[model samples]
Target: MQKKIFAYIMSVLLITLIISGIFTVQTIEKQHFSNMEEKLVSASYILSQVLSEDIQADNIEHIKAVLSKVSRELNVRITLIDRQGTVLGETSYDPSLMENHLKRPEIQKALKGSVGKEIRFSSTMKLDFMYIAQPIYRDDYIAGVIRLSTPMKEIKGLMKSINGNLLLALIPGLFLSLLLVYRISISITSPIKEIKNAAVDITLGKLDPSINITSRDEIGELAKAIDFMAASLRDKINSIRDKNTRMEAILSSVVNGIIAVDSNENILFINPIAQKMLNIDEGDIAGKHLLQVIRNNKIDNMIKGILENKSFEENEISLNYPTQKIFRLNSNAIKYPESDRIIGIIIIIQDITEIKKLEKMRSDFVANVSHELKTPLTSIKGFVETLKAGAIEDQAAAVRFLNIIEDEADRLNRLISDILSLSELENRKGKTRYEIINTADKIREIISLLQNQAVHKNIDLIVKVEADVRMLHGDPDQFKQMLINLVDNAVKYTPEGGKVQVTAYNTKNEVVIRIKDNGIGIPKEHIPRLFERFYRVDKARSRNVGGTGLGLAIVKHIIMQFQGKIDVVSEVGQGTEFILSIPRET
Candidate 1:
């Protein structure tokens, strides 16, 4: 994150440096050239004025003498051109070989009574030259022009040296500028860190905000802002603490544990439930290694993976023996610019032990019931074929065999129906029809369907529903089927005179459905396994009752399909109650 800001800064600074460098170099060059031009014209003007009279009278030798004097004195070559563009006299060039000069733009301007100059390359001298032209006037009228030409190569060489020095200046200037910017950035950030540390200390200590930084710029203003923010945070944090007392009480009332950590695999905070589970009691264990406190390697690895890579997921891993603590670690990272450093990470740990138990039991029960169902179907098919070969002609034997065959077929049909229902409920990942449903009405329908069976068993099927419940969202058929499965399971387990109650209600966060039975309660040891696909407290009795054993398993899965939570409380030989909580649509 810091690199992003650094790249942006570098780009802006580089552009500014290049633009300013070009402007500065050009300005210096232009001023130096102007000064050199003015000096050349001034010096040549003196020679033109001194030799004006002699030149108009056609004293060519005297013109050459003046030319030589100017040439030697100013390190320049002099040439005198007449009004007709012919060379009258020249200091260095052989007079016999000279050409016309009046046609030149500078020479014409000079003959017109003005100073003229041109910088060009000279073929004879083989160098870049600056020519200064001035008219030699006898009576302030037209006359020949006195022109002095000098190579500007020397000036160009001087400019090159100046450019080298400017370039050198750029290096040192840029270095200092960058250094200043870096120091300013650090100076600005340093106080922010102090304020941050103080705020953190205030939070950990549950005390007042205290920050210290001295400056008198925008950074100083920001330091003041930090001080104000810290004070505000302290007050708000206190307010939160007060409000959280009730929240803490509510969370503590729950049996599940909660653990929240930082990206560094350090235990940053924990709730009461988590504290109880971990058995930690100290002044402050906030910044300690999780592995040092948590011995469970599986959970440690999960937490590390999630915190490092933001891998939020579900898994069943043991936290302690005799008490299995399953957790769903939902985690994410926070990236903040820290001046060329890395971002931060956080992990949230939620105990899903009860939900995990339900899932596992549901799995195991399905497997067992499928085995049971296959066995009977296989036996019936084998027996029917054995009788068909030899007993077909015997009327008495055939009649008895036909009755058994019909009964077995009915059993197979019933088994198939159960399997279909279970599969439909369990396969939540598969597509299914869902719609808005009156959960209360759906409950009544399921109870009515199961009422006759309850009556046959001399069981009282009672229902309590909130009539004022608004319409809800779900697969109504699936919901009804799940309700029938749960109630049927309850009746099957209950004694003849026991009562079964189906209740539905709503809270602020969710709609709840509960099936309670005063029946042969599940043994504490077997309760955890009850929801497994074919898991049974009494395998023999479940088989005798012709149960596929997938009833509760199907119920559990259907509840989950609608994004709900379930829990069962049971006591051996007493009673069992299954509670399902479904979140309300927002």
Candidate 2:
């Protein structure tokens, strides 16, 4: 701005100086010419009066002598021409070489009895001249013409001096004008520069409202307005920051994973839960494309569908990387507050693998229970129908059928009892009454009870209990029932002359019980579902051994009630072992 103002000032000054110098030179030139013309005319008239007698006589010596004296006095060239336009003599040039002056403008005018003046270039002298001519008269008849000429060098010298003076005069004025213009420019632009700097700080989020322009001009008013605006903007920014903090807290506290994205599928907000569920540890993934952040194509498609439909969408998405997880993905489009335009999307994920597994278990339990109950009922119905059709007439046949009916009823009763017991243990939630009982003693009692079965099959049964595991806290009946199930299963599965071993000991704050048998071992695939209700590795063999298939499941539930864990190790054609770990304190 200063430079622009100064340039304007200099331009105007230069133009003004140029015009003034031109006018001054022209005026001086015109005035000098006018003065010279007057001098020439007066000199010519005076010389004509003195030289007319000489000219009438045609006395060339006298005319030349007089012309020389007058020309020296006046410092001008004097030419004398006769009526016939012949130059007799001249002060400077040779008369023989001089041209006739008959057709000269000044001479022709002077011949007509009028004073004539002309400024022209003289070919003889090669100089500019101001010429004034007057007619010389003798007895009222024109005898000759007297013309006075002065060279233009004197006027030009005066003009150069005048222009020099003008330049000298303008130098100071130009410098002073430039100085004043610079001051004015500073006064105007200083405050603007300060305001510009303050605005830059505000853009960078430094909202300091200090501008030191104290004048009451428009610039000052602008500074005050900017200060007020900065205050308001700072308040708004702080309010927005507070709102974001609260929103982040709410998102972090939620149990479900939440993801928010923009219309272009760029991630805007992703909570820690979402990060964990997605197995991502890269911090600050916001503003990245959704596919770049989350690598699952199914979830990406679900988000796309929700955004395209601008409605809600729910899907069960399975993730195989990191770990296998089943997520119930619920997605919906976010819209403007009062308009139907879609903004982005909001997605929530809830893990539902456990819930699905429970549903499947319940469904399988219902089918197994129905099948287990129907088998015995069908057998009893068939036997009774046979007896009612006169099969009771034979005492031997009647006794055999009665015994079969009794055994079937007992098996049905055992199955029903085990099922009921399992249900009760499963539904039991809190701690039950637990008394500290001798661990070795409990194992001895259970083994003795199952010893008869082991002997019936001619299988060797061994019992081993650690001396240090004297007592553990649990329901003694449940503990005894749990051990009976394990030992009985081992004995029943072992072939004749096979060995079954039961061991109990203390391991790290828990009582460890293991039942091992050398028999046809369970297959690897069946171990995961071994404790499920009515799940059998060999259906026919279990039925033949009078097994209801609920014993292991019931034992598992009892151990769970005692806050214990059960594991099995088995190999085909080698052996099988069931290991139980129960807390010793409770």
Candidate 3:
């Protein structure tokens, strides 16, 4: 801006100076020519008066001598012409070689008894000249013409000198003008530069309210407007930031995952929940295509459908990549406010994996309970019918049938009790009773109670409690029940002369109890579902051993109440080990 202003001002000043100089030189040249012409006319009149007598006498030689001397002194060419249209005397040229003077414009007017002035090129001398002619008279009659001519070169030289002086005068003026223009440009552009810098700072998120411009002109007004605009922009940006922070908080706190995409299917936003649900990192995910982040076809299809239809859509999608999970996707098209133009889509994702598992468990549990109850009731009914059908008269047969019925009734009662206990555990919620339990005493009690069974089978029952085994914190009855179930299973599964071992120890943060047996081991595939209700490895053997298939399931519920984890290691015939790790505190 400074350079442009300076250049513009200099250009205008130069143009004005050039025009003024041209006109001034022309005026001075014109005045000099007028003064020179007047002088030549005066000189010619005086010379014409003096030469008239000589001309009348016809002393042409003497006239030539006199004109030559005066012409040399005046630096002019003098010519004398007769009225008969012949050159009489010439200073620089011979009179005989000169052209006729009667046809010359100045000579013609002089012959008419008046002075004449003319400027034209002289063909004989090959130079441009100014001519002034006066009539020479004798006895008040026209005798001849006396003419004086000077070359135009003298006038041109004078003009050249004038032009040179003018140029010299303009140099300092030009420099002074440049300095003034520089100061003016700085004054105007400095304020503009301040405004520009301030605008740049605003773009970089720096808002300075104290923009002190002291001028009262338009530039000052412009600066004030920009300062106000900056303040307004700062307020607007802060407001937007606060709103965005609140929106992020709300989205993070929500349980359901949320995603938003633009019309081009690029990701606009994704909450943390959505990032976790899709098993994707949240960094730099915005503006990426939806399929590039989450490769699930069901979610992509649902979003695409919402986009194309510009309406709501929903779907339940199962993901098997990161983990097996069922997600319920609810999607709807986003539109411009108060307008129907579709802009993007918003999707809400609800994880229903746990809910679906619970539903399935409830259905299976009902069927298993009915089947287990019906088996024992059918056996008892069959025995009773057999006794009624003349089996009572056969004394030995009736006694055997009644004993079998009693055993079936006992098994049924145990099954019912186990089912009720499992139901109670499942329905139990909130914190459990935290009682300090002696680990060695509990293991001993379990071993003692199950020892008879182990003896009946001729199996060895071993118990080990490490000295460092600390007291565990949990419901004492639940802890004891959990151990009994595990010990009993070990005894029941082991064949004759097989060994069962129970070891209790402590780690830094947990109480570890391990029950291992060298018995008819379970298959690797069955270990996962070993604790499920009514699950059995061998149905016939389980019934013969008076097993209800609910013991391990009950033990699992108790461990869960104590916030403990159980792991099973088994092979077809080697052995099975159940490791229970309960936290030192509830």
Candidate 4:
């Protein structure tokens, strides 16, 4: 920039100097030639008057003498010519050797009674000269012509001297001009240099110490503008960083996993939860292709669909790589601002395995409740209709019909009660009234209540509980109910002579109760859903045996409410054992 400015300044000054020198030299030369012509013409006129008498009388010697004396005094060449273009006398050249003077421009004008002047190269003298001629008159008739001539060398010498002086002045003037131009250029460009550096710093994220130009000129205004731009950029950068920080925090804290990929399906960002959901390692996956990282065809294809369509979509997909997990995935195309072109894709994955299971459970619960209620109502309705339509006339038949109706109604009531209890347990939060109780005592009470059923079935019921396992913190009634349901299910399911045993023991952190029954054991397929509401391995046998189908569900819910755990081990024909772990002190 400095070089360019210097070159521009020097070029202008050099051109100005050159043009001024040419114009000055030309004007001075023109003025010099004008004055020289006037002097030559005047000299010619004056000598013509002096030489007129001599030319008329044809006195060559006298004419020659007068012409030579005037030539010496004026330092000009003198020529005398007659009207016939003959050279009469000459001071510098031999008169006989000269060309016909009458045909010369100046001599012809002199013959016409007018002074004429010309500058030409003389072939005879072999030099350049300025010539002036005037006619001499004798008694009003043209006698001869007198011409004055000056060598052009003298004027040329004067012009050369003047041009030399101009060149000398030009050298110093150019040097001074270049220096001034350099100073002015620096003044203009120095502020611009600072602004350029400041702009560079701003790009590099250095937003302090703005360009300092104090001059109240365009450069200073530019500096102020740069300062303003830097300030604005700093604020914008900080705001972006702050917003990014907040966005990261939000993404990190969200329960759903978030992942962003580019149009080419290259992962751009992956939140912490996304890493866990995708079963990816806790390392950087950015810039890696999504298929390479996750290897899930469904997810990759969904992202491709979003990119192609530039729209939003949601799907439920299962990942079987690390584990079997169901996820509800929402994908959206990320676009350039105000444009439809897709730049990337954003996907949110929410783990919905538990939710799906719960949904299935809810559907099954509705179907089972409807079936349970309908069967009993159908039975009661049939029996009541039988008694109403002439069966009442036979007392034994009517009594038997009433008993059948009462049993159906009682089963229906029990089914409805169990359903409502299970629903309350699931929906209610912090509704358990907890109290300290004895684990062994609860088991003994449950056994005593169900002893009659066990006796009727001819099954041996045994209770084994350690003394230290007595104390446990839970809802006393719930714990008692949980024990009764397990024992009753055991007795109800056991064939005659099958043994049912209840055992309670204390561990470091918990009290455990085990109910073992050598009944027709449950199938392996039904073990997973044994605690589900209304899920019976043998539906006909369970209903005929007066099992509500919700007994184990209620027990499971009570244990869960107490933050306890329950596990069941059952074999097809060997036996089944229900183990319950309750926090001893909680």
Candidate 5:
């Protein structure tokens, strides 16, 4: 801006100087020309009056004398012509070569008693001249004339001298203008350079609010304003940093899994809890697909629904890891502003494996314990009521009520005993140490104990084992109890004359024990919840057959404590197969 302003100043100065110089030269030249023409004309008249008297008398001596004197005084040339057009008198030039003056243009005009002026070129003089001739009248009659001539060549010389001086003036004026422009430019540009440096430093993030202040003009004010702006900008940046620091701390400390993604469903950020839960390798998964990195299909599906159909998603999904544990995934989606367009998805994952187990255990315990006790309690109440209503007075009614009460009580006792055994199996910390042993001998021992019951029902109870089954690590007493549960369940569920088989073998990492029985098989929907407490495909039959409803749940907890897995396969009315796969301990 300063450079441009200085350029404008220089331009205005140069134009003004050019216009003034032209007008000055023209005015002086016009005055000089007018004064010179007027002086020459007045002198010619004076010479004509003097010649009028001399020519009327033809006095050659007086004319010659008068012409010479007038020529010397005025610095002009004079000539005289007679009525016959012959050269009568002349102050300069050769007389013999002179033409007849009577018929000449100036002489004829003088003879008519008038003054005439003309510009003409003279060959002898070799220049242009302004010639004026005035008539010498005698009593308003004819007379000879006196003429004055001036060479215009001298005026050309004068103009040339003036132009030379003007040229001299032009060089110095231009030099001075340039010097002025340079010096003033520095005055304006110095402060500008400082401001420019400050702006550069500020933009590059080096300096803040420390630009130079050089003047009291508009430039100085602008510098102050910029400095103030830098200060405000610095403050805002600090505030943002503080806010971000706080947010980061909170995000890190959270226990539940949190992940934030962009509009593309790319993982922008994931908290430590989420990273650990999902088995992610990197702290930052910026460009990876949310599902690809986290390996949760539910996360991908939920985000797709929110982005495509503008719907919300929440569901429980299962996630498994090779070495650590299994997870129950509960995912949720939300639109920040429900009315506005959804920009991205935020997913929260909760480790609900333990919560699910505890919930199932609590609910099952209540239902099982109540049902087990309710049967016996209700039978006793009925007997007491019958006695109160005089049924006790009839011996047959009393005997029947007493028999029902005793049967219900016996069912209650069996339920308690099974519950105790299951509780003991679940409490591995309270159980004895484990050892590697041939569990086939112990399985055979349990088959012998339940063999009479199997024969009474005409069932074929078979025990199959590897010819040289490898020893597996386990607690003998608990192992035998596990065998008892399997054999007992098989005998109770299988029809008369059916085959019940107990098989054992050593798989690479562990020994697998399978119990297959020809019985009513389980349905597909009941397979998953079979290990849950109080869960049974046929509740009335399970209870009528003296099932405590805590057996499978207890078995599940025991297998988990031993770091093992169990599965059941069945088809309704065909048979049931229970496969227990336990890891061989070191």
Candidate 6:
């Protein structure tokens, strides 16, 4: 910028200097030429007066002598020409060797009775000359032409001296102009450079308010404008930053995952949920192609379709890489507010994995419930029908069949009771009665209640509790029910003469209870589904033991309500241990 300004100023100065110099030289040269023409014309008139009588007498010697002396005095050439276009006398050359002077422009003009003047190159002298010609008259008739011509070398020498002076004068002018232009350039570009740097800083997200330019010129005005613009920009940027922060907060807090892409398919933004869902790094995924981050064809194609058609689209896509999850993608084209021109796409992704699992569980639960109820009801109905068909006539047979019917009814009652208990635990929501539960007393009560069954199976039920086993805060009845279910399951699963142990203790934040048993131990793979409703390791053994296959499921629901966790460790041919860690406060 500085260089450009300097060059521009210097160019104008140089042009101005050149024009001034040319005009000055031309004026001086023209004045010199006019003065020279006057001197030649005056000299010619005096010479013509002195040579008029000689030329009328045709005295060539006298005429040539007078012309030579006058030419020597004036440093000019003198010529005499007759009316017949013959050179009669000359000072610089022999009169006979000169070209015809009558046809010369100045001579012709003089013959027509006017003072003639011309500048021409003389062929004989091989120099430029300014000529002034006057016609001499004898008795009111033109006798001859008297001409005076001065060589232009003198004028050229004077002009050369003036041009040399001009060049010498221009040297200081150019140097001074250089200095002035440099100062001007600095004055102009310095502030502009500062503004440019400030603008650069602004682009880099640095807003500096102190751009101090003190000049009062146009450049200063520009600086002021830039300062104003920077201030406005700072405010705008701050506003935008605050808005972006709020937008990010809203997006982050939303349960659904969100992604926004531009028309070019580059990712504009991905919320935290989306980043986690797609297993993408927030820093790495921005401005990246959609497929580069997600690599899900269905979502990418859905977004593309919406972008192309300027319409809303939705799809359920399953991803298996990060985790097996089902996501419902609701996408719509983001368009200009005033028109339907699509600019980008916004996709709201809902993670439906848990919802789908719950749906399937509900369906299976209904089916299992119906099957379980039908099995016992069918058997009871068959036996009653049998008894009604005349089996009552045999008293022993009737007693045996009635006993079977009663047992089946008892089993059906237990199943229904367990089912109702599980449903109640699930539907309890947050309506739980809080009370202190003594872990040791609850275990004792559960053991006494299940004592007969344990003895019948010849199984030893042992309770080992820490003296400081903290009292838990929860619904006391729910706590007792959970303890009973765990203890019963332990006793029911242990083989005859095998051992079942219930341990309760306290941790930093939880009341830990462990039920361990030595029995036909479950396989490692079945532990995950052990708490599922109606899930049995050995169905025949379970039914023979009069188990409803819902005790653990009920225990699971109770533990969930207490905001506790349960884990199982088991190996085939080895013992199984169920560890329940319930928070002490709930």
Best by the TM-score measure? 3
Ranking by TM-score: 3, 6, 2, 4, 5, 1
lDDT tens digits by residue: candidate 1, 162-276: 8899889889887887776676566656776776776677668645556566677775777678678767887888899999898768766766565656667777656676666
Candidate 2 C-alpha lDDT tens digits along 1-586: 7678667777877788789878887988888878888888888888889888886787878888889999999888888888878887678788779888898898899999999888788988899877898999998998889888888876787778887887798789778877887888787788888899999999999997579988888888999999999999999999999999999999999999999899999998899998989888868899999999888898888887777776685789888888778899888777899998778888898888788878989998999899889998999999999999999998999999999999999999988888887887777654566788788988898888888988899999999888888477778888888888888888888788999998888877898989999988999999988888888999998998988789998888888877889999988888899999888863
lDDT string, candidate 6, 1-586, tens digits: 8999889988998899889889999999999888998899888888778877887788889888888999899888888888887998888788788878767899999888788899899887899888899988876888889989988887899899999998998898889889989998998888888888877887887776568897898877877887888888889989999999999999899989998899989999889898888788657678889998878787778777777777686689898977899999888777789998777888899999999999999999999889888888899899899999999899999999999999999989999989898888778877888888887788788888888989998999888989878887788888888888877787877778999988988888998999899877788778889889999989888988888689889888888878899988887767888899989853
| Clash pairs, model 4 backbone | none
Q: Any runs in candidate 4 off by more than 4 Å, and if so which? A: 1-21, 38-75, 78-116, 121-123, 133-147, 157-429, 455-460
RMSD of 1: 25.6
Candidates, ranked, lDDT: 3, 4, 2, 6, 5, 1
Global lDDT of each model? 0.75, 0.86, 0.88, 0.86, 0.76, 0.86
Provide the lDDT at 47 for model 4.
82
- Model 5 earns a TM-score of 0.55
For each predicted model, how many residue pairs clash, with residues at least 3 apart or on different chains? 15, 0, 0, 0, 3, 0
Better of 3 and 4 by TM-score: 3
Model 4 lDDT at residue 129? 88
Clashes of 1: 15
Question: Is candidate 5 or 6 superior in TM-score?
Answer: 6
lDDT of prediction 2: 0.86
Task: Report the lDDT of model 5 for residue 340.
Answer: 59
Task: Give the TM-score of each candidate.
Answer: 0.39, 0.70, 0.77, 0.63, 0.55, 0.71
Candidate 5, 1-586: lDDT as tens digits: 6678678888988898889888888887787777666776788788777676777687889888888898888777788765666667778876568876665566566677776666678654789876777776776765667777777787677887898999798999889988888788887877778778877877887547466775789989988888887788788888998998888789879887888777788877788888887788865577788877977676677677667776555656666564334454443444466565555667777777788778867786877688778877887888889888999899998888888888888878877876776666656454565676566787788899999999998999999987766565766666666667767888888889899999988888887889999988888998888877667778889877777666676667666655668878888898888888878643
Candidate 6 lands at a TM-score of: 0.71
List ranges where model 5 is wrong by over 4 Å: 1-10, 23-153, 160-364, 380-407, 420-437
Identify the runs in model 3 with alpha carbons over 4 angstroms from their true place. Answer: 1-22, 43-105, 120-129, 135-153, 156-253, 281-285, 308-311, 388-395, 466-469, 505-511, 583-586
